[model samples]
Target: MKEKVVAINRVAKVVKGGRRFSFSAIVVVGDGNGTVGYGLGKANEVTDAIAKGIDDAKKNLVKVPLYKHTVPHVMEGKYSGGFVLVQPAAAGTGVIAGGAMRAVFESAGIKDVLAKSKGSSNPHNVVKATFDALLKMRDPMQIAQQRGITLSQVFNG
Candidate 1:
């Protein structure tokens, strides 16, 4: 598994010594095999922030069901003021996403997906919304089981 830093922000706090500066980072981690996660970390240094972010991401890992390099159906997720729409794409269409969403798709090993972020452009909110959508995904077999029906029955009926 590997981790990627999606964004880094510098924050400052007013103190007796004028200001104290810190770093905040957004990180995505994955095995490129249907598992992915994201995290936010704050620290006094860049390296520390990134390391913390990766560690946090590992703790929040999520499994994404892949269907021929794409999702099985279209879905939407929302967090705060951020909204994300995700849809399956044909082979060779490639991943159509931007910023945090792109990092998420790549980390999840999604080769063909169409995604758009709406409303808020904040990286934190966007990442959260993307994860929300991925977590909402349901596998066909799981759905069939929940319905007490066979896979073939699901397709035929």
Candidate 2:
């Protein structure tokens, strides 16, 4: 598996003597075979922040349903003020997402998808929203089983 640093920000806190500076990093990890996760880390050093983020991401992993290099269906996810809409795309469409959404899709091994982010643009919120959407995805087989129907019945009947 490999990890990608999606975003990093330098944060500061005012103190008695001066401002204390720290780094916050968002990281995405993936095997390019369907497994993926994201994490946020804060530290005094950029390297440390990224390392922590990777560790956090590994602890929070989700499995996504992939179909022909895209998601199985269209869905919407919301977190706080962040809203995200994800749709499956043609094989060659590539990832049509920006900022945090793009990172999430790439890490999830989704080669083709269309995503739109609305409301708050905060990276944390956006990332969480994307994950929420992905988690809601249901595989066709799972859906069939839940409904007490066989796969063949679904497609042919």
Candidate 3:
């Protein structure tokens, strides 16, 4: 399968009595050419949390716009309190990102991409919003059909 569970992190919440620990997971799944999915899970155990997150991600797989080996355009989205920006890049550019963002791209089989994450740094929100944005993407074939035009007319014309 092309899908992968990229990273799992232990998170803690401060409470009145003590610290409450939980596991946060980021799962990325893709077919490399264009489709990718990212998911987050929070639970008492790291394995269970990651497994749940991956399952959710698979259930929510999305197809993103791809031009050559990179994204077709730049886009942004917000989830919870995090903002994510995804941009296409030329070949050999590689993925210029860190943290959960990088893992998302890698699992999605993206070799070259540019990304920026802002606002809340929560991994779950960031990953989820990114997936949301990607899921909204439109491919040339779909666009041509929607516009009632040929692919060449829509792109080359």
Candidate 4:
């Protein structure tokens, strides 16, 4: 009762034999504690597809470190011929992203984010690239520690 599924889609492929149909699932799972995950799955059936996607997503879950209600920095990421740009915005900025990108941000518990997708209109690749960007995100604390400098000095520098 604590899990939520966002969407499911049917994808098709035509071969010599006939038309082959598969399902694609986009799932948003979160605890509302600044943790969320997005997954994509394809299968012969909707339920199986969703189950597969959810399982895979859980297994690949990455914690996105948040600053207040937004990301810690701006980052760009690419995957499977898709490109995504993610920007941190001031509070109340709201989510300004396309459908695919929106699902990724919303599931990640981000309240305010700005995103742009390019190179590919395929939702799967776009969302995956966005998640990759989120996974690469680093907070100030981590940066300061890695640089062996105090937080104040790091910020000032």
Candidate 5:
């Protein structure tokens, strides 16, 4: 699986002796074939935190519906203070997004898309919002089936 480290934060806690420091990592992982997941892990060391994150992400893997190297339709997602809007783009447009969102897209094997994150720049919230948007995506064929119509009828109508 391919993995991207979206953020690593050094957190400190006050103790009797002094300040104790730990590392927190947020990571995204994928098979580069429409499966992706995100996780957050904290540990005393960066490498350990990253490893834990990868394991957690693998457990949360989700399959994304892809069409022509992009999302099938427009989507909006929100998590706490973060909001994200994702839409399909032309084949050659490439992934147009910011830091946290880029990692999620690349991991999900999205080659073309237009995404915007608003309300908060925090990686954690942005990633969650992006996931929400992706989880809500529905392929046209799936929609047609759910509506008891043929795929062609959906687009034709």
Candidate 6:
């Protein structure tokens, strides 16, 4: 799996003599297919924190349905103060996104998509919101089933 570090933060705690410092990392992992996951880890060192994040990400892997190397439909998601709108794009459109939202799409193996991240730009919140949108996507087959129609009928109608 490929892993990308979305954010690394240094946290300090006040102590009697001095301050205790630690690191926190947010990571995204993917197999370059349709499986992706995100993780957060904390440790005394950046490397350790990243390692933990990768392991955690593996534990949370999820499969996304891809249609022609793009999202099946428009999607919107929100988490805390972050909101994201995701839409499918043509094959050559490429990934039109930025910052943490870009990382999430790349990790999810989506090659063509149009995304806009609104509200808070916080990487943590953006990542979660992106996942929320991705997880909410449904395949055409599922939609057809839900509508109690044959797959061909869905397309014909």
lDDT of each: 0.92, 0.90, 0.77, 0.81, 0.96, 0.93
- lDDT (Cα, tens digit) per residue for candidate 6, span 18-126: 9999999999999878899999999999999999999999999999888889999999999999999999999999999977988888888899999999999899999
lDDT of 3 by residue, 47-114 (tens): 88878877877777766666676666788878989889988888999999767777677766778889
Candidate with more favorable, higher lDDT: 3 or 5: 5
How close is every model to the real structure, measured as TM-score? Answer: 0.95, 0.94, 0.75, 0.84, 0.98, 0.95
Question: In model 1, what lDDT does residue 114 have?
Answer: 96
- Model 2, range 1-157, lDDT digits (tens) per residue? 6798889999999999999999999998988767889989999999999999999999988788877789989999999999999999988999999789888888878999999999889988898999999989987798899989998886686
lDDT of 4 by residue, 1-157 (tens): 1245556777789999999998888775655556767667789999998888788777666678898889889999899999999999999999999887787677777889888998997877887788888888998999999999988987798
Compared with the true structure, what per-residue lDDT tens digits does model 1 show for residues 13-131? 99997999999999999998789999889999999999999999999998998888898789999999999999999999999998899999999899999999999999999999998
- Model 1, which residues run further than 4 Å from truth? none
Model 2 is weakest, by summed lDDT over 10 consecutive residues, at 60-69
lDDT at 102 for candidate 6? 84
- By summed lDDT, the worst window of 10 consecutive residues in model 1 runs over 64-73
Q: Extract clashing residue pairs from model 4.
A: none
* Clashing residue pairs in candidate 5 (N, C-alpha, C atoms within 3 angstroms): none
- Measured by lDDT, the strongest candidate is 5
Better of 2 and 6 by TM-score: 6
Compared with the true structure, model 2 gives a TM-score of: 0.94
Model 5 TM-score relative to the real fold: 0.98
Output the lDDT of residue 27, model 4: 73
Tell me the spans in candidate 6 whose CA falls farther than 4 Å from its real position. Answer: none
